[model samples]
Each structure stands twice: as C-alpha cells, then as structure tokens.
Target: METSSVLIINLLVWFLLLANVLSFSTFEKLVLPPSVTGPESASFDRGGEGPYVTVADGRILKWKGPSVGFVDFAYTSPNRTKIACDGTNDLKFGPICGRPLALSFNYKTSDLYITDAFFGLLVVGFNGGLATQLSGGYKYLSGIDVESYTGNVYMTDASLTSDSTGRLLKYDPRTQRVTVLLSGLSGGGGPAVSSSRNYVLVPDYINKKIQRYWLQGPKKETTEVFLTDCGSPKTIKRAVNDGEFWVAVEKQVQQQPVLTEPQGLRVNGSAVVLQTVPLTQFSDMTLAVVQESNDALYVGSSYTDFVGVYKN
Candidate 1:
C-alpha cells in the first residue's frame, strides 16, 4: 500500500478506537508538577560554593556548605540573582524545546539567548525588555551557548530523524541564517564553545560521552573525544571564569545504583571529581549553569522545573 494510504487507514482505525474510549491521554494531559517556589534573597558564598535553587519556583536547598548554580531556562540572575525563564509549553512549539532548554549570555550584546522547548530560540535583553523568538520549526533544540570570540550562537537539534541522531547549528544574527555546522552526531546535545572560538564541547547523550570539535579546521577532522564512558552527561556549559566546562550527567546507575548518583564535572586546574553535591531530584534533561557577577553559580533542570544554585 502507498504510504499515504497506509497512514490514512491507520488514522481511521485509531480515531475509531479512540472515539470509543472514554478518556484519552494527550501531550497536554501529561501532568507537570506545580512550579517550585524560589527564595526572595538566596544566599551564596564567595569562592565556588553555595546551595542549589530550583529555577522555576526558586526552592532553595541548603547544604553543609555551598552548591553549584545551574539555571535551565528561566530569568537570569538580575544583578547576580539567578532567575528562571519558565517557557511556554504550547504543543506547536513545546515539543521542540521539550523544556525551553538553552541558557547563554552575550556580554558584548548584553543579551540573553534562550532556546525554549516550545519556541526555537528567544532573545531577551539583559536590562529587561520584550523577549523575542530567534528560530522556528526545529524538531528539538536541547541547549544554547555562545562563542566568546565572535559572539556567534550554537545550539543542538537533539533528534528529528530515524537514527536518533542530532546536529549542531550556528546562528548568524547579521545574516539571520541558521546553518548546520555538524550532523549525524549520535544523540548530540548541550554545546559549550571555547572562549577563543577554537573548540566546542558537546555531550553525546546516547553514546555516553563528551566530544570536542575544532571549529576552525575542516569539518571531517574536527570531531574528537573529550571524555568517553563519562557517565551520561546530559548538558554542558563552559565556566565563565575559567576556560573549563561543566557537564550534568543524568544518573550514575542505568537501572539500579551500586554507588553514587551521576554528578557534574568541572574541567579545571587538572582537578576533576565526580561531585557529590546533588543538583536535581531527577537528572535534569539539561545542565544550565552560568556564573554570576557576584561570583556565585546557578543551575537549572527541566525535570524538576527549578533552577539549582551553588556558590562559585
């Protein structure tokens, strides 16, 4: 049978069966928890330490010391305050962001670029103004990050194909062109670009690895492994102060754990430890971390719908 004919027949049967059913579940029917409440004035330490704040609601989780900051898609820290941008979950654009999962700041432009799961990308002014969309009709964009050298944007298309593959795209505002930089990356998502614009660190979600690519050289020779079998880091962001990057691995155990939960890794000063500081109740779909002017840290999680905070 022709593909269209087969699809029509399947649709007819599905509609008939669904019509006979009393209640049906839909994407909208899926229940998302009420947003977590955040703190009015969350506290943090001076040097790389603090508690984690749930971005959407701003629920503060205190610790013996400080925690790491990871803000997903919420308002930025307005004057060193970590704010979450709870994006829209409309179906037409909702599935694209899955949770509006990108966080990046352009110091030169003083603008924040966020990739809402429902909308492609939203550009908001740092000084507070209208937030606008940057792209449209993308299957899924996991996270957004900027290149320090040229102030260009890079993001991930988690999957829109049969192979469960993903690709990287460059957003050139001058030309308003979104071009695919690399493709066929198995489960590629969460991009972190180097300050000098030399390399990009990407998390291979399905492959359980972190890969780096040279942006200047030929595309074919660019892909290289930064860390393989590195738990299952879902999202990554470059540290603001240092050139090192941080990755949020979903979980340590696939089904059941024998040891610690998966943690974030900071590539800095020849020191990398599987952090014990828990950032999310569930492994956040993306790790949205940024450095604040006050030297604190903020992180975000899609599953929890809150931004986690830590003192930097």
Candidate 2:
C-alpha cells in the first residue's frame, strides 16, 4: 500500500509538470490569401482598428474583417505595378517592387513609417496610397519604430556586406534629417523605445544579443548589451506594461537537418526576462514580430502566408 501511494504521488507530480509545459495559449492561424505572403511585422492604428502588416510583395495591408480580409493600404514604390510586383518574393525585383520589412505608426500625425529591405525608409499618411521615400542609400533596412511623442523614427540597417556592417539610424520627420546612432551592429534587428521615450532596445540578430541605447536621462547617448544568448531575435516591441518589451526569437536546432523553433519573451527595462512564451506551433515559419495588444499576442512571419494570434 505504501509503495502504491508513492507511485500515485509521483504520477500526479509528472502530470502537473506536463500541464505546465502545455500552459501556452494555442495559436490560431490568421490565413492570408495566396497573393499575400510574409507579413513580417504588424502594427495597429490609434483607433485600435488594425493589425496592418507589411508583406514581402511590397505592400502594407490593412485587416478589415474576416469577410473583407486584408485590403490594400499602401505601397512603398510608386513604380510598383501589380503585374510586376504582386505575389512574388524574388530578391532581384526588390529594387522595383520594394520589399517592406518593418512598420510603425506615428500616432500624433496618423502616419505610418516603414523600412523597406531595398528602399530604406518610407512613410505614408492616414489615407494610404504610395509611400514617400524618406531616406535611402542603404544596403538593407530591416527594422523601424516611431516615437509617438516626437514623430522621430528609429531604424536599423542590417548589413552592407555578409559581415557585421550594420548601423542604427534616427530620422527626424520635422527636419527630414537622418542621424547614425550606432554602427558596427551585427545584423541589427529592430528598435523598441521605452514607455518614457528615453531609451531604445535594439536587437543584434547575428550576435544573439539585445542592446539598449539611452536617448535621454543621465545615461543619454550610451549603449550597452541588455541581453545575451538570445536566439536570433528579430523584432522588439514595447509591451503593454510600462518599461517592458516583447522580443521575438528564432531558435535554430541542428540535428541531421536544421530545425527552427520560435519564441516570444517579455523583458523589463533592466534587461530581466519576465516571461517566455513558446511559439513552436509556428516553427516552420520565421516568426519575425510578436506584438501585444490588450491581452492577446499577434505573431508575424516574413516567410509564411499567415499571421498568428495567441490569446491568454
């Protein structure tokens, strides 16, 4: 009887552990049409009426409803024609079709700023159509974020060569001036400013680290590694909580063939991880952006034909 009781207790303990491991919310796929692929990043408007996404085919699409699906919001290049650009992911046509990667909104002006993999940075007003080119002359513009209070844009240039020739830049909408904040970043991912607007967290994808750059306060203009050993973080977005952020990470597992596991982590301003959410259900896709709105998490991928929503 004593042995049987001990066996039952151990079985219960293992059951609880398994339950904890499966505690994550199940992700429901938000499927896009065949023409739309690679919704790399998602942003919502001031009115809370969108999960507007930038697709690989060079268009920013707005989600209207389940029936209407995503409608055309904006295009990066004015020369982009449907015949030449739609439903394609060829890098050679990137210069003409304009592969948009990251997106953020300026709430004050109701304008959206985007980083094109080929076109550098661009913006469009509330009534979207053709986005105006704000800055260019960069090899690859990977990520972007807008300061809601000042309308200034922070962005990252991933690389010039195969090495770590990346750079972090700031673009002033008022003056139209572009300033380089930092260079020598190893595959810079994305920038997410703090709630106080005093610091920005930038991810180094190649180095598997996140760096914090102070924009204000006593540590102004200083940069430091916020977190290390992060598995190829892609986009860092401000969390719903103050002084916290959500980072999307892609973990590569090498066996005979390589496998990828995606995850989302919540970290505080002091570089402490608060929570980690596994996104392995979308492992086949490159989860580039994980954004939080209300109590739900929105996941975007640059290689999948769907976005994912996981609600807690």
Candidate 3:
C-alpha cells in the first residue's frame, strides 16, 4: 500500500453495517512508539493474544494493553541495525535491512509467517526473535495467509518489475516446497481463504478485481472473478462474527500519492457488498487494512503512527 498524510480518525456516522450494526464509533486508538510508522497488517494468535502489527522499520510490534504499549516482538533482517533502519523509509535499505509487508500466524503451530518486500517468506516461533527464511526470490510479496488446518501457506507475488502479471503461490510445509497455483493476476493484496476452506478470495490491484481461486470441491484449482467493482482492493480479512470479509480499497491512480474516496467494505463470498464505509470521513488516511476482530474494525495505514479501532 501507499503512504499518505497522517490523520486521526473520527468516524461520527451511522449506518447499517451488514444490517447488524447499531452504532459506529471509534472504540480506541493504539498509538505506535515514536519515530516508526506503518502498521501495514495485523494478526492475532490462536490464544487470542494479539493485534500484532508489522512496521516500516522491518520489525513486528505487539500491543499489550495501554500500560505496556507496543513492545518489540520480532524482526526479519539478521543484518538490520536499529541505528540504520529504525523509522527510516529509504528504499535503498530495504534489501539490506528488510521491509516486512504482511504477516499471518499458523494458529495450529503458533508460528508466525511473514512476507517481506525484500526478504521473501519467513517464519518465527511463539518466542519471537529473528525469523528464519523459508523461501527466496519472492520479491514484492504483498499478502499472505496460512491455512491453519493443513499448514499450507498461500501468498501473492506482485511481479511488478518483470511484467506486472502477478501470481498466487502456495507453500506446503511437509515438503518445504513452493508451488505456483495461479498466474495472470494483479496480485497486490493479501488473500483470504474461505471459512469452509473451499476457496480463497484473491485481490488484483492491477485488474481491479477479486477472483476466487478454488482449493477443493469440483471447482478446485480453478479461478473466477468474484468481485470487480472494488476500487484497487488491498487487503481482504475475514470477519470473526460470520466469516464474511472486510476489504480496504482506494481510488487513486497508479503510483499516485493523493487518494480519493478510500473505503472499507464488508462483502460476502458471493461477491455481494453488504456494507460500505467511506473512509475519507473517518480519516484522511489511505488504509491498506480494515480487519474485523470481534465487533470492531481495525483500520491500518502504511504511514500512520496509530491504528484506529472502529466499533459498531
């Protein structure tokens, strides 16, 4: 996702969210430590312990209530030095210090999987430290999700430098091998495996579409356009309430800095848009993640020092 001017969110509006929402308000704000920014994506452990977020400095931070604030959880680069990498946005340091973009936990094993724009895919244990690299040559890896049932890792590669024709990849833990499941994708956002584990919804930033890539059933190993009207969809997250998905979208030109009508959408697997929240009113922030945890929505920006918690 792209960065925008840092803005505090104040969502003072009312609407029927999935016809179940009663009120819309900011529940709380999780402010990051000074200097560092970009809580690009978040995840919780199997024990329901976190809203752990990845920052721009190539490290992951965990929230432990208001008193403890955010503590150092993990980092991707073994060569990274805090003096050179912390709070910096220099692209030249990406390969040297690593820039972790997305993360998902294997709840079954308590291992966290991470995708760095320069470090490929890596995993760390429950006791956080330097993560171990799993696979390499996966540059610009955007989103990642692990199927806790089988330990199969699903991720996307936005092959921007090569052809801009992205791909969907899967990693089998048993064989320690990576497989290309689908190709010809825009592949900018993270993917969501369905609640039933039948298929995964993948977002295309180039095509402006969300396609269903089947995992099982008669339609297994096939792909279909699940959504198209979503504006440059970024990250798709599953709701804890009903397994429905919440997506973050932005109306901005390619490589543009200014954003317009950024929104968060609650959509079903059938591609139905259940509810839409215009994010411009909430914050001037251009979000990359709108995740649902319990009855609240966690909105994340790549350049903000705080993560906004919206409730209904």
Candidate 4:
C-alpha cells in the first residue's frame, strides 16, 4: 500500500510541473526600441492593423508584426523634433517634446485621438503624421476614448496638483466644442465608453475607484461609483466581449511603498468582477494598460520597454 501511494504522489507532482510549463509557454515578450520606454496605453486601428502605443518619449508607434517590429506612427506636438524627443523621458521637456499618455481610435473617421501629458487633446488622421492639437489648457491629460456612433471624444485630466483637481472632458467633433463633463476627479486614469455608447467608465487612481457616467439614457449627465477598492486601477479598456472591460490594477505592498504585483480584472457593466488574471510576472512594474483581443492579452507598462503578450 505504501509503494502504491508513492507512485500516485509522483504522478501528481509531474502533472503540476507540466501545467506550469504550459502556462509559461503561452507568454511571449515583445521588445520595443531602446528609446521607446513606457508604453502607457495601446489601441488597434479600424482595420485591426495595430497595437499602436504611446511611449514616454512623446511618440506613438505601431506594431508591424515580428519581421518589421514597431514603426513611428504619430507625434503629439508640432514642435517635437526627432533630436529633442526621440529617447528622453525628461518631464521638464514635456511641453516641447510632448508626452502622449492615452489614445483611442475614432472608427468612423479613421482618426486617432490622443491625450498628451503636456499637449492636451489631439488627433491625427489615418495617414499618421503630425497630430493636430484640439485643446491646450490641461495640466496633465491622462485618459481618452472615442464614441464610435458619434465622433465624441471623452478624456480625463489626471491632476493639476497632488490634490483633487482632476476632471473629465468631452470634445464634440460636430460642433468643435469642448465641454467639462465632471470635475473634482482625484487622479483619473483611463476613460472607456460602453459598446452601446450610452455610458462611460473612468478610473480614479487616488481613490481606488471606478466611476460610471451616463451619456444618453434617462440618467444622462449623472455620475455614480461603479467599483470601489480597486487596487490603484490605471487604464480601463473595453473587452472583446460585449458589456465587459479589462482594468489594470497595481497592487502595492502595504509597508514598502512599491508595487509588488499587477493584475487585470474582467468586469461587467453591472460592476461585478468576473475573473482576476494574475500579471505578477511583470516584475516591479505597474501595468498601465491591459487589453484582451483574439484570445490573447496585451499588457503595457509605463516604465518598461517591452509589451507582454499572453495567450488566453
């Protein structure tokens, strides 16, 4: 009996080892250019041709597959010159170099809308050259989303100071007017419009909460708390599935003042979390964006030079 029990235990151990190997096999690291550090957010074009990302050096790059890798796609500011901004992450040069933080595609017009930390809101056409600035008075722009049904762009200003001076703004393409939707947001992250275009979700990084703002329903213009106690949630992106979203959460060690783990949560419109995917392998990095598509997970970090891809 003892011999038989030992054999069964060995088999179980081997099975567990195989499972771990399989999980690791599904993960792949895609390295970017040495200068392209901090890919804060990513988006795909209408033709599904890109995982186009905004980097720290004030440029947007588009992935052209393994053979070609990422190529220059757009720049936020007209003043940004290759010699001045190509490889630097200096905050002092942000106004001149243009650090783009968030981006979303307007499917109808094939235009990409961007939110730059120093340049305010901007957009570039499908051809992708110099981005045109639409607004210019934000202290720190962070998140952006475009409503496909109506070319309305929604974005968040992270903060004016360490205090709660963050706000949500909407820019209408039809009228060329920008309106303040909500004020007093405490360090906002990403804003994602619902698939139905009736609502939008914005994350509050300082308060660790996600807020839902209504756009077209009876609750139009009303805002409410969607999820609370989310661990330093950064960017929120719509999932491939209807009514679902992927949120990046930076889990920090309580005593160390450092991020220990990063996680992605799949949540529904009702604010119920469906699944929590562990992204701890990112190693000492805070994941700024978690997007899922085609049975694969695309992870972005604000301090790393590479994007992690995991087969789901």
Candidate 5:
C-alpha cells in the first residue's frame, strides 16, 4: 500500500510539470494585434511636428509593457527624426532611457530630463547624454516637466499606496533643490506646463478630471473639466505654439500593452468639445511637444511599441 501511494504522488508531480510546460508554450504563441482603427472614444477630429503619424512597427518594446512607468517620446532637433523612449535599458546615471518611463528635452541646455518609475527625476543627454539623479526615496516618480526658460523641473510622485504620499515637486537645476508643489492626487500621471509658463495641465486620475493650476500658490487658479470619464489619464502635454494638447488614456488590467494606457488625443481649432481619441494598445503616457511647431506630430506608445508619425 505504501508503494502504491508513492507511485500515485510521483505521477501527480509529472502531470503538473507537463501542464506548466504546455501553458508556457501556449503563452509564447500569443500575438498582439498588428494595426488598429480610428479612435473609439470620440469622432475623428485631428492634429503636431516633424514625424508624420505613420505607424512604425519598430517602436514596440517586445519585452516591456504595463509593468513599466511612463512611455514618452522625444525627437532630435533640426530634422526632428529619430525618436527616443525612456527606460528601455539599464544604466547607472544617464542610462535612464531604457527602464520603462518618460522623458523630455531641454533644448536650451541640450539635456534630456527623464521621469523614472523606479529612479525618480533624472536628466541625460542624447545617445551619450549626461545623466543626473534629481530625486530618490520616492514611491514612484512617474511624470516630468521642465521650464524652458528657467530650467526649473517639475515632476509627479505618483505614490498612490505610500505613507510618505504622492505629490508634485519642483526642482531648481541651478540650485539643485527639490520642493513639494502639491499632494493628494489619487494617482498623478501626465503633466503639461502651459505655454504661458504660469500654470500646469494635469490629469487627476482619482478625481477623473483634467486640471489647470497656477505655478505659484495655485489658490487663484480655476479647475475645469477638460474631459470627463477618461479611463486613467496617463500623460498630458500642451503644444508650444498652437495652444493644442494631448492625453494618453488606459483601460486594460491584464497582459497589458506597452502603452497600457492608450495612444493619445489631439486638441485644436478652438473647440469646446475637447474631443479625446484612443490609440489602441499603446498605453501609459504620451510625452508630447514642448511647444507646437511646423514639424509633424510625433507620438510614442508602449502597446504599439513604436513612435507614431502624424502630420498636422
């Protein structure tokens, strides 16, 4: 009887191992959709700079996705070709681009400011960029913005489940100081600095509203609903010249696309409708133009895993 029991246990172990092998093999075969249609959120109304919105399959990160932080896009100057996404690798300082996060460029300083989900606010140069560690000991530093004039850096600490708390912070590059700007966001994600350089545009995840706040005191500011019922508004950016902006929304909760959030939407032509478009599969954040220009619109997504070139 003891021998019989032992034999049964051995068989069970073998069966379980077999099942796991089969499951892993099946998972490997699962492929994502190649292309997507128009926005599912609203009617087709359009939109940016150098790169025309052409679906480039090259942007997909085969190994990264929902687990990542902000997926931002940046184009090199002059011709504005060759886009860059953050946190796609592992490096000590300037190597912040490969880690699954967001990035913005300070064209004045020739520096790239990055929001690292794991590392906090950082700055690096292009290709051989100089990386600076701006913050540490925060739950998650998800979004980043820079003052084009003063080079003051503002970032979001999206620490939804932490005791220290989530807050928007200001960092002075000249003095190397960091200060908390605001706290009590449900989950702070995307942040766009107004072209006038006085206020900021943010998607308050918990509140489910797009908010505009003053750079100082914020008490004299007005908060209006730019768009309602957006899934988890991830990143926000206002055009440098045109007063237009973009937002990336996310809905899924599973094997998640790289963008996991949504692609993005375009705002233009003096419409109060504030129409929002969905970039299917592309999730997380859409770090867009510092200022709108004659160049084509360039957007990067984690789901689609490629930078989209849209002609304005």
Candidate 6:
C-alpha cells in the first residue's frame, strides 16, 4: 500500500490480470495515439459498441472505429492540462493529471464508473467528459466492477495500513456508503461476480490464486480460495460466450515471481482450465487485460502504447 507512486506505472510489473483470447493466433495492435500509453483495462458499453480504455495520460478514450480512431471520452482530473499531461507516462503528474486504472459501466444507468489511482472512485454520464469523484483517500486502487442488478460497486485496493494486506470493498450507490466486504486479500483486479450473484471472485495476484467471497448463501460472508495455480491472473472478467471467466495470467517459474510470458486462461466455476490462449506473440509487451467484446478479444498492456485486438 505504501508503494503509492511506484504503483501507478509498475502495476503489471508487480501484479497482473487479463481476459480471454483464442489459441494459436496473434494480436492485431491498436496502437495508441501520440503520447498516450498503457491501456491497462478495457470496457465496453451496454450496447456492445466499444472497448473504451483508461490511458496513462489520465484520460479515457473511446474507440469509435478504425476511421474515427480513439477520441477523448472522459478525464479524471479537473486540473488536467493537455499541454502538461497528454501522452506522458510520468507518475509525478498523477495527482494533478489523475491516473485512472480500471473502469466499468452500469448497464442500466449507462453511467461509467472508474477507479483512479490518485482520485479514487469517479463517475461520468453516458455523455463522457470530466468525471466527478465519488470517493477518495483510497490507496493503490486497482480493479473495479459493478453489479448491474443492485448498482452496487465492488473494488480492491492495497490498503493504506502497514499490515501489507489488500482489501475487497463495496460501495452502495443507494446509500453512498463504502463497506469492507473482505480483507487480507493478496489484491489484484476488481472482484468478479458470479452470474447468479452468489459469490464474487477477487484475484490474489501475489499468491497466484483467486479468493471467492460469498455474497448470498449459507456460506454468505465466508471466504475461500476458488482457484489455485491460476498463473498470476491479471484481470478476471466474465467470458463473452460462456458462463465462465477469462483470466489474463503469467506463468510463474519455480514459485518465485518473475514476469515471464503472459497468457489468457479461460476457466469455469469448478476451477477447470477450459482454454489457454498463448500471448507470447506480443513479444516484449507485458499484456495486462485481454477483455472480450462482441466476438473479438481486446488486449491492453501497462508497458506498451497499444491495445492489441485479435482479429480473424
């Protein structure tokens, strides 16, 4: 949690996550615009029309199409300046420029929620521009997801305490209150809810597993390890086609953490590896999230200036 400044740029280098892609194929690079970099996480609208990404320059850009390319959708910092912050990877400008990490959309409300490293939770209307902060004072905010049914937002953070533990927290939009759902998390991306809403999976990146927190059941409020040896999952997202999850993972060598080849692992609730998509084709880029929209996979990275999409 103390690694506040170091965390902004070295997220993938420290802990990682990703979605799903197919096997035996290469990712088509969606090279980012000038000066912008590290499309760390990707999200699509309810209408299935995008892969709007949060970039290093502290702005979220929407991909309109190949012709229109990426246009500024929303920004986190009210003090953000195009001249000073645009397209730069420097962490010193985070507080002034607002370093955003993960984003999700409320399908019903059509409001986009974001987790900014410096600004905490922020939201913008469907119209997208400068975002309004909902909450702040969180340290090392990473992943975020919204439950469409309740409109409640759940997220993970490396807490500010010296305990060196991560936490899974929930925000109720109705009450505008934040509560700690679970603590002692190894901490990765946002908690992923089951389709049934019975439980949510929070990735423990350092431990290379996912901790499942029960939301509804006899086991409600209990915590358990759902998946082990999950290859340092970067991001855990619900799959587009199946009732499963696509996790971006990095294979660990000899139990010591090393950033080696990153891959896409699709798995079911029973902890079965359904499919593995080799992502070594991207070469040196440390791929973070491989989110799927419509039918194609959109891959984002913390070390590159592009979001690689897999095309047939």
- How many clashes in each structure? 44, 0, 0, 0, 43, 9
Q: Which of 2 and 3 is the better model by lDDT?
A: 2
TM match of model 6 to true structure: 0.88
lDDT by residue for model 3 (264-294), tens:
8889877888777666543556577887775
Candidate 1, residue 280: Cα displacement in angstroms equals: 7.3
Query: What lDDT would each prediction earn against the true structure?
Result: 0.53, 0.86, 0.82, 0.85, 0.48, 0.82
TM-score per prediction, in order, is: 0.62, 0.89, 0.88, 0.89, 0.56, 0.88
Q: What is the alpha-carbon RMSD of candidate 5 to the true structure?
A: 18.8
C-alpha RMSD in Å of predicted model 1 compared with the true structure: 18.8
For candidate 3, list the clashing residue pairs, or say none: none
Model 1 TM-score relative to the real fold: 0.62
Which candidate number has the best lDDT?
A: 2
Ranking by lDDT: 2, 4, 6, 3, 1, 5
Query: Least accurate stretch of 10 residues (summed lDDT) in model 1?
Result: 22-31
**lDDT per residue, candidate 4, 206-274, as tens digits?**
888899999988999999999996687888999989999999987666555664678888899999987
Native-to-model Cα distance after best TM-score fit, residue 150 in candidate 5, in Å? 1.5
lDDT string for model 2 (24-140, tens) is 476687777676789888899999877899888888998887888888899998789998999888878887998899899998888999999888889899999999998898878
lDDT tens digits, residues 1-312, model 5?
Answer: 999999999999898666533321211111222342111111001221122211122111121233542222332111112234222222232222223255555657656676654446666554422345666667667677677788988777876553435576788988988987667666757577766676776767656556666765554454444565655566676653456676655644556343344534545323232444443324344332222233433344433333443432
Structure candidate 6, residue pairs in collision:
16-234, 17-234, 17-235, 18-235, 18-248, 19-290, 35-87, 36-87, 143-190
* Candidate 4, position 55, lDDT: 89
CA RMSD of all predictions:
18.8, 4.7, 8.7, 5.5, 18.8, 11.5
TM value for model 4: 0.89
| Model 1 agreement with the true structure over 236-270: per-residue lDDT tens digits | 76655566766766555545544335455656423
Q: In model 6, where is the ten-residue run with the lowest total lDDT?
A: 15-24
Query: Where does candidate 4 stray beyond 4 Å?
Result: 1-25, 256-259
Top-TM-score structure, candidate number? 2
